[model samples]
Target chain A: MTTNSISIGIVTYRTSLEYLKRCLRSISFQSALDSVGSVVIRDNDNGFDREIIEQAIAASGLDKSLVKVVEGDNIGFGAAQNELMKLSFEKGESAHLCLNPDAALHPNSIENVLEFASSKKFLGIFEMEQFPVPHPKIVDPYTFETPWCSGCSLLIPSGVYEATKGFDESFWLYCEDVDLSWRVKAEGMHCYLVKNAQVAHFVHSRSNDSKEDQLRALPLISAAKHLADKWGSPRFSKDMAKEYERRSGISIDSDSLNNVPRPSPSSLLKAQPDFSHMLVFSPSTWIEE
Target chain B: MRPNITVVTRTQPGRESFLETALFSLSSQLLVPEEVLVVAHVVSSGPFVELENLIGAYKTQFNSIQLLTHSFEGDGRTVSLNMGLEKATGKYLAFLDDDDVFYEHHFSSLVQALEKNDNAWAFSNVVRAGYGPDGNGYSLRERSQPFKRSGYSFLDHLYENFIPIHSFILDRDKCPSEARFNENLVRHEDYEFLLRLASKFPPYYLDETTAEYRIRLDGSNSVLDGSSGMTSEEFMLKREIWVKSNYILDQVRKEIVGWWAPELREVTEKLGRVADYLSTTDLTKRMEEQKKAQAMVDEIWSSTSWRITAPIRIAGSIAKRSPIPKKPKVHSLKDGHEVVNEIKSSFAWKITAPLRRVKDAKLKKQP
Candidate 1:
């Protein structure tokens, strides 16, 4: 039998049980997945609905033997990806796909990625449109020619990941993709946006309440540190500093600021809620038909 | 008011005399640092003991001199400064390397400039020195410092950094509380920190010459001869920032939007222009005009008074002393000078030389 070519690693952090099920169902029901490699779900959340998630996995009706679910140490996104890269390297997998939990690839997305990969070697980011509300040309992940592959639907060749030493751990949340793409570019490898491959990223839904708040706040803080690291921190103007604070609300509170690191990976995984709230804003099945 | 300046020094091999002279120059100056903290990185046994002795001798004249030593944390300049910042108890921070000296008016002038303007974090024009066996050479010249353009907005400092960090006095309290010297960065760590700081504070220009930034070819860590390779930490540091700059630029765009919405439109227009330029392989007439317009923008940046004006002032000295052709010769034209006497006598001699010489000879023979 021919070995599987691509292994997909999805980090499901605080993803709703319904969304996870639907996402898994979409992946498992893909007609092109027979030659697909293993699907490894590294859960960064404190806990998840095992019965519901497992049942959804079973209902997708793909080969159950091809699945691997690993519990992570709650070590943020970059660290988790690094772990995936290590595991894939050991297994001799040819390529790795990093997918967000809320995103679902179209039926031909994987096939197209593979076909395009055969012609040109690259780390691919799929052309993404928001789910339920598609802008067809909304520029969120990149404003210009996509500089780096987005983590939402990134496809990485095994060689590129190893040579660049994976993503940096210092970047806890935001800019990890930016960091990775630059590293890939530095190695003389190109980062491509596979316009042919389509994936729907269900970004910023009301169901992901707590996670969204954390995501919004953390990205701003990381962004300021990123600026500080790139430009000289000592010369930041009052306007510049105020602008960073205005966007993120992370202030220079001497009372709150500590030289200490955040406590060891708090897995504040609350019970996954019913994502029926999304249906309120989302179109009905009849409407879709 | 006295500006509390902190001088950070790390002892290297065979540089004790230079360090002592640097310290003595500070001590002799009427306006010295409020407290000079010498944070020495004691690597080997060579000249560290002498540094200790020098610090011990000046314990009384100085304002609470503290000599702290760390057993070399793998040659990271950013890490060293971060460590110094943690221990520093100063209102304003000024960095001076061990090999450099400050003129007598350095501290007073910098402090005066800072006092005059409250909105400004201080920076000064530097005099680059070339010291050798004959003391400060002809290369000892005063010039305006180059400030970073990344901090500027339409009229304000947007995010441009033009001054070298070592050449400025930064307000400690007003500085971004979360800012750090990317201990990971070996090369552009200072640049990185300054960019962050510039994002938060408006830097003031001090046009006066304050300190001598020494460039001795004989120093232990001379830019030309320093052979220390990148540490594993430094390599990891660059890897960290290379990944971070783009991520930060994304944030930078967002932050820019928050303060000045107009700048975002301008930046987007610039990006559009770049994108349009990228599409055309050969420059069309329209594209050529756009290129010329871009060149004018560049010329405006280079010709700005506060920006590259220092080089304009130095061009005269550079031209005269320059080994290149086409420099006009300059000579002293004083009335009592030898050249003047030679010029005056040459015309008189040509007018009456032979007759006067023959008459004098005839008179002498008769006598």
Candidate 2:
């Protein structure tokens, strides 16, 4: 077995420089970052200059030379993450940590998660619990097995990423992680929460910026429709399509459902996506919302 | 006045790491603060040195991050806050405790709200999060909006403090003298400070949860925290602190907000009775709490109802049944140093402290 050297992928939109700097600072403080892992910032802004991105990285506390900053057109989130991880794989990193720009990891987060992941016979996807606000999803207290993993602070082993082929790019923003997690499980791999690790991720839930909210909400609704269609749940798909039209004020035909991609027949037989519970899609939740 | 914010962050020795996170939070704010003041209430120079080194490492991110070391003999939070308040040079003042955090937009949105309104201070909504031990480090257990943010009333605030310290920003020009925190209260220092500030300037509530209030249940830092890992001795010490807090609050309550609603005092006294049910306390400690309570009352009285409102005081004096003393010693936060030069020497003031407390209590008894 190879030593699991980690590579981090931070998919950034027009993220706050302060958030990015603090995020970088958090990762740096977690021990010797340079030796154990590499940090990559894959920018998905419409037209952010490379210089501006470099300056932002420097301003954020990272010596820009140490970080690999990629800049170009808005490639969408799922695609950017996939691209970064693939690049990391080529560089021989055993695992990829999909970190959000807004996340601040606890100093022992990486070390704890790595230790836990290595203890298992077959490595799977390990998710770091969000601090200050833990997601209202279930993760077994003792075993650390979760129904699905949120990509906000997820760790994917090289094998799992190669098998699942990363997040479905059809999902521009949300629900992509759920699809990928389900696929990982269907492939007979495990998914879990690294019980001891925490990453401080704030969902700016109460910020009254309707403009940004609208931009964020539309993609989320669109992603829901795509996810539902991919999972072969007609009811959820139809409902999400209707919701998309109502919320986005755009009329779309049933064309979106047909364009949805699918896995091989054998993989579909293994994949079982549950939509029984509305909003939060899981059987057991540790904390109430 | 220019709209630069001076963020005051008070931390003790153990919370140095948390303090680093807090400074990073400040660094990421959309509205950059003009200054950052970190008050370390360490009894020994060793912890203070560690804090100094830590702050020095992060000094590149902040042009002006000053560390003020305080050797507070008692409950240190309020005194630490007062120390920050004294040195704050920015036009507007904000506070972020070491353990708590602010989102990037926390300051920008607050300052924007303050700019739009005539109110001296504006507060954003803050969500409370509970964290516990997970072996490697503390992990968040749950989160809740424990405080009601709508329809803020200063009268209602007297009953309970719903606002977190980091949630609000005050314009120094508007409430200069009223800015000091009551050093007496061990637990609810932020609440006590808000009461005094809110009494004068009705804060503009921004109605957004831009900051977070974190509490650790596994015997960690923060108020109303730590019972699981606390040993019997630790529990008893914690119990005594709470008792002193209750006793001190009761003392200040009588001389401060107790005038308008005497019934409220009765309710608090009832709560005090409930605390008394727990254990028999030390009389010497009670006397110490009483003295601290008098100091708190003095701080509240010092948060003067504007000296400009003399005519109203004269008119309202007859209706209240008693007139104030001929001389009311008013101290602004900035002029805190000149009190000795103005009147009684430090020696005379120390000796007559009991006599002064009695007189102030009588004056405060009038609504």
Candidate 3:
């Protein structure tokens, strides 16, 4: 066990067991992870491709004692993270890592993140260099700046997670990490990019045959939610709305397409609106998955 | 499960090379389409002789290439897609533009996703790939990740339609047998069809990069400079349709939020606290006061400020005052790229630069 105690939380949707096995093996092999007593797999109950993942775990022959699986109905991403956060509080641990099922941690990624959390004066947000995918820069969500860590592999310090209130359940998918990082920054805490840490992320397909079109709409809805949350929806402005939809991978109805109103007077006065040129509907209009 | 696949292609004469590439990509690397049907308009231009030549090459490679060339009774592309659908035989249908290429993993990925899930309406991210003036190939665009929601419904359709026309794959069993692309809507026809599809099935995403969406200078889906301007007549019609649809959706969404708002007060209060918790400059403080001035608009959204403020939101009418725009805060790294200033620190500069200067100074002293 390392000097600080950290628990890892992995959220699994409809992912393959082979990947999960690879994921567990990678976490188990973390050179500095002895400090981690338990790794919780919060399985979003679509009956996770369980048989294969279990077989893979057995094949890897890692200590089964350190692994625990939690099954539940389809809770949103933020809710799942909150569940892990609640678990951490129950165990009296200080921090929990929200790892994507498709992502694998490097040997010392947890240690590096913890090391930063242990002594850093302010809220520290560090993202790893996503392996196989060459995105070296970390982005700042508040500014839409590049290099913000992809949620695929993020180490959440317990303090920052609690302060930020975990992921926003309103954001069912897409940009939850960006929203979290932004919310963390909103609380006056700083997010960082640890150049040394590396996480292997296997980008998975979000859609299968059963619900193809609905899967396509997820990003569109999330984008609208993001824009509505960040840049109040405007009355239809086709250009800005199209740009928003294209860039965010979100879609909107043709009338409401650019029909969301411009920034409310309150937002204009409180802080500069991030997307003044774009239009959005009320944040309430976003569909929860 | 067998490869339940359908191919939707609208062909014209001169696209011989595009046809060859599409056919080779579809037949060689991906799942063999249970039925490959091509809908071509009888028109003037490239040699039907050459079109036949391309068809022959594809047929040699795959057994199911059926060429159904007809002089369309209508003049729109959407009509052509509707025509193609009438002839499609497979249970799973994927739209392929005449000018696109399918990656090796496209069919396999779609097939796997369909097998894994109970509902099989899936779409994958497409790479905007372009051939340079020099004949070299390069990726022009990239998608960061696949979307989260996966179920087809009308509300999903009403939300947005960013799915590229050629990027979608449909299940034939749940397929709207009479569904037709909106022939009158030239610009957003795909958006309309997707909306109809979403109403019926839960959509899914194949996060894999499965196809290359070619960006051609002519005869393609690229939006040109003047092309962005909407005709006044077309604009008004679109607006009328949108307002009607959004009203219904808005009503439903508002009711859902209303049911939770009383219990969600804590969440709202927390959001308010989070808004107040945002870092403030002297200017930011004044902005906060101004936000409270307008009671009707409970929130403001824009890209300028790094934060989103939750306002004392009211229903129905919008506030008269529009928010001012601000530039996002940015900081530059030593490597010349800039980032937001929140993460900037003098310590980062202090940690990175001194070693180089120290080495240089020591060399001079030794000399």
Residue B266 lDDT (model 3): 56
Minimal lDDT window, size 10, model 1 chain B = B327-336
Alpha-carbon deviation at A11 in model 3, angstroms: 1.3
Docking class of 3: incorrect
Name the runs in model 2 displaced over 4 angstroms: A1-7, A12-30, A36-51, A68-73, A102-122, A195-200, A208-215, A249-272, A283-289, B1-74, B86-92, B97-99, B115-119, B131-142, B177-179, B216-367
Q: Ranking by lDDT, best first?
A: 2, 3, 1
lDDT of 2 at B130: 61
Number of the top-ranking candidate, with lDDT as the measure: 2
Fill in the DockQ of model 3.
0.02
Predicted candidate 3 versus true structure: per-residue lDDT over A1-289, tens digit per residue: 2476777788787777656665676676566767786788777875565665567568544688877778788787768877987797579777777787766565566777666556563265666655423242323323222323456767677777767667766556665665566556556565565534656553434234435654555565544445454444453234445655665566554443244234346534432333432222111111111
lDDT for each candidate structure? 0.54, 0.72, 0.56
Question: Candidate 2 residues B314-363, lDDT tens each?
Answer: 56667777865344332221122233223222222333434544664486
Native interface contact recovery, model 3: 0.02
> How many Å off is the CA of B95 in candidate 1?
69
